[model samples]
Target chain A: MDKALLSTRNLHRSFGGVHAVKDVSFHVPTGAIKAVIGPNGAGKTTLFNLIAGTLTPHQGQVIFRGQPITGHKPHAVAALGIARTFQTTKLFPHMTVLENVMMGRHTRTRSGFLAGMFNAPWTWREQRQTEAKARAILEELGLTAHTNETACNLPFGRQRLVEFARALATEPSLLLLDEPAAGLNIYETQQLSQLILKIRDTGITCLVVEHDMSLVMNISDEVVVLDQGHKIAEGPPAAIQRNPEVIRVYLGDEHA
Target chain B: MRLRIYYPVLATAVLIVLLHLALAYADATYYMTQITMSAYYALVVIGLCLLMGYAGQASLGHAGFFAIGGYTAAVLTTYNLRPYADAPFVSLCRALGLTMQWKDLYGTDILSFTPWAAFGSALLLTGLIALVIGASVIRLKGHYLAMATLGFGLIVYRIALGTPVLGRADGISNVPPFHLLGSLQVNGRAPFRIQNYYLAWVVVLIAMVLALNLVHSRVGRALRSIHENEEAAHSLGVNTYRYKLAVFVLSAIFAAMGGALLTHYSGSIGPAEATVMKSVRYVAIVAVGGMANLWGAMVMGILLNFLSLRGVFGSFDDTVFGAILIMMMIFAPQGLLRVPRLRALGSLVSRRSHA
Candidate 1:
């Protein structure tokens, strides 16, 4: 078996006795697209938060790139070649779409305060390179036309694309996307699923927490099932589809 | 690039022309001095604009930095140890024909140094204090940050008022005038108010240029990111805390340099200058001018300072600013600079079409 790009060991997080995640352990293999799917309140988002350093686990360790990164800050995680998009689009508003993505190139580039203030030649060179890289990513994501528009001014579906482009600009080895297709229509969903596959093909490991079974099952190489803070099952998408426990807890459980 | 050079050069030439006009009419009168005083306030407001406008952080301890700068200048300029000095440096100073100039006031001998030295030391001291204090304080957001900064300002104000060596409420006076590049003198036995006026505006211009360069850089984008959504910036690999602290300390340096120069120009210092109200006025000036627009803040600062000096709006300044803050927040909240969002877009489209 190939080494996991990211691994979590028995993670536990609770809020005022409400356990959001309990004894959750998972691993995303390098260069593979993995999805964590479950019912609402199944602790999928909370688990993503723990891995992204938004919250510290009560009992667990998150290992990334063969290094323990438990309790590291969000920026530290990003600096360590891990990047993520929020459940909601978290792009900087009042900034141009290109600028938003260019910001992601921060950790990848080096420039000090004085250097930036003075607009040193090296700073300009780095900035031009950053802009070129950002524009290329934006172009690849079909967002080049709106590069100069304000980020928030974009339509919801387009905003999500912009965010994905931004996360990609970080040059991350691991990308944690929280429901990238949550607010999208079926067409947009299919497009996003295709994009996720494309991202994985680019040699980036993807850990996506999504509710759309069709989107998750279509693109993910492996799917982990969660319900009420417990991992009920984990396997290939076809096996998870056949697993009776996942069926009972997630797919079979329907809203009245 | 030419546009950048054009605007700044045009601005400098215009300010110089205004100074030329003022110098021609003025006989170095008290009113002329007050107008120059307005120039220094403009510098302080420029600092606040960078802080509140771009970084989206409010500082209530801004005046604390200013007072720190003032006192640092005062100590460097007025603390003479010549007659009672037993230090070897004092003898060396006399032997090398570099004895610091001295003055006598209220039966006390005061050591006076050149203006540039005082300004340099003031900036260094204020920057050091600001860097330490800003690291912890800028972690706070919104009103909590404001309260923390206010607490710092209050603390500094009290220390300056109660501390004896700082001259308590009186503050250190007889601050020596600085000679611009060691040729043009400002405020001494043969004081030159025009020189000081030109010097003050020149500093303001340099500061403006620095701010322009900053806002056009990657650091500027990083700062605005911290303002809009700090967590998003952090997630994007921006050290939000570090950038916030950097801007805080830089803005404090701006205020500190202004205060240091003003202390020298005014030829006196006072603890009253460091009061919380003064800090709020700086905030008000930035707010009224539109926090994001440096030029707007500079203009409003000069205009308001003139009004306050003329006794036309002395006590009413705060009341007017408070009302303006309320109205602007309600009507234009992004800032006084921008009209309502729809109108702003409408204007933008209209202007674009025209262009």
Candidate 2:
């Protein structure tokens, strides 16, 4: 069997009198789209935060590419090829869209601070290449026309795409998206599903935490349903759709 | 190659050079002296602008670095002398050939080190101190960092005031003026004030260039990203703490170099020179200028320094500076640089009417 791209082994997290997440374990295989779906306050977002290194799990091992990265700092985790998007789009609002995207390329840059300050030829050359790459990413996301605009000035849907592009610019082996379809319209959601598939085609594993069942069911290769910080069901999309637990969680027992 | 920027910069450079030469030939010592002091003050303000305005790091401890630089020069110049003497261990080490002191290693009096050496050493020392302070204190967020740095400034001020070995409250005098080459007497000769004025201006100009480059680089972009959203910056793979510390150290080095230059130019150093009030004044200078624009700092620094030299507000310089800072914060937070758009609009109208 192919090695999992990212896996959590018995993950546990608690906050004073509340067990935010407990005994959760899942493996995301390479080049697959996996969705972690849950209701409000179900710890789906907290799981993303834990995996992304924003929060530390009390007891767990986050293995990425067969290496443990449980308690590393967020930037260090990002450097190790796991990138994430915030639940609320967190673009550098004052900077131009291109600049915001370029910031994601910072880790890949080789130029030192002194070289950049002096405007060395190599620094300029690298900057030009990064800008070109950022433009290409923008073009791919249909955001090329908005590259020069401030991130805050973009429409909310476009901002969402910009965040996705920014995350993609980090060249992550695994992408963890938190509520990528939260505020998106139907068309945008469709586009996002297409983008997720495209990303998977590029050999990047995806672990998406989302609420929109239609998008998740359509795009996710496997689904893990979370309810009140515990995994209710885990299976392929069709199996998850028919699961009694998922049905009861979504629709009441009377509707189910 | 943007003429809009290049033309003004070129014009300003020419004007400053012309002014320097004219003052050298004008035979007015007092006015020339005032210009020299103004240039030094401008240098401090430029560094302050970079720290507070561009990096968005609140530092009330700049005067601490400034005072340290001054004392470094003072203690080195007075080496082994009574009252302002070197430490006993250092003196003993120097005598026993266990270690070559900085003074002995250079083989010149503290005053005679080349301007470049002074500049480099001052920057190195200041950068080292700032690195230590920044690593410890930069983790504190917002006003806590500000208050902590303010406390540092007060502590440094008190050290300068209370320590007799550092000249106590009276400070050290007869700071050896900067030596150009080995033969050229830039001080105590014909047009000495003019020479010192130009020297100080050149340092200020270099500081401004460095500050400008820093603010436009990738580091600047990273700093702004952190300023806007620290968590976002981190998620994007920015080591925000490292960047903040780097900026803090760099800003301190610039301020220290400015202080060193001022010490040499004035031929004196004092505890009062690095008071908490002095740090506040530098912040006020940055505020009066626009925080977002380096040129704003340059313009305001020169303008305010010259205004004070001309005694435009007499003993009310402090009051005036404070009032300007408050008014700018309230009404025109962007400061005088924002008014240029009006001038551009006026010119556009005039051109259309003429056509």
Highest-scoring model, lDDT: 1
User: How well is each residue in A198-227 modelled by candidate 2, as lDDT tens digits?
Assistant: 999998999999999999999999999988
Runs off by more than 4 Å, candidate 2:
B1-9, B21-32, B81-121, B183-190, B332-355
What's the i-RMS of each model?
A: 2.9, 4.9
- Please give, for residues A182-254, the per-residue lDDT of candidate 1 as tens digits: 9899999999989999999999999999999999999999999888898888989999988878877754655
Candidate 1 fnat reads: 0.66
Clashes of 2: 0
Model 2 RMSD, rounded to 1 decimal: 5.2
Model 2 chain B lowest lDDT segment of ten: B346-355
lDDT of 1 at B320: 73
For candidate 2, the per-residue lDDT at B86 reads 60
Q: Which digits, one per residue and each the tens of the lDDT, describe model 2 over residues B1-355?
A: 1123334456667888887667648855566666666666777677677667655677878889888876776555444433322668555644654332234333543313344444566678878888888899998887798899999899889989998878887887665656656644335334575566666667667666666555656677788788778899999888888888887877777677767767766666899877877777777778767665666677777778778778998999778877777776676654444455643643442221100
Look at candidate 1 and give me any clashing residue pairs.
Answer: none
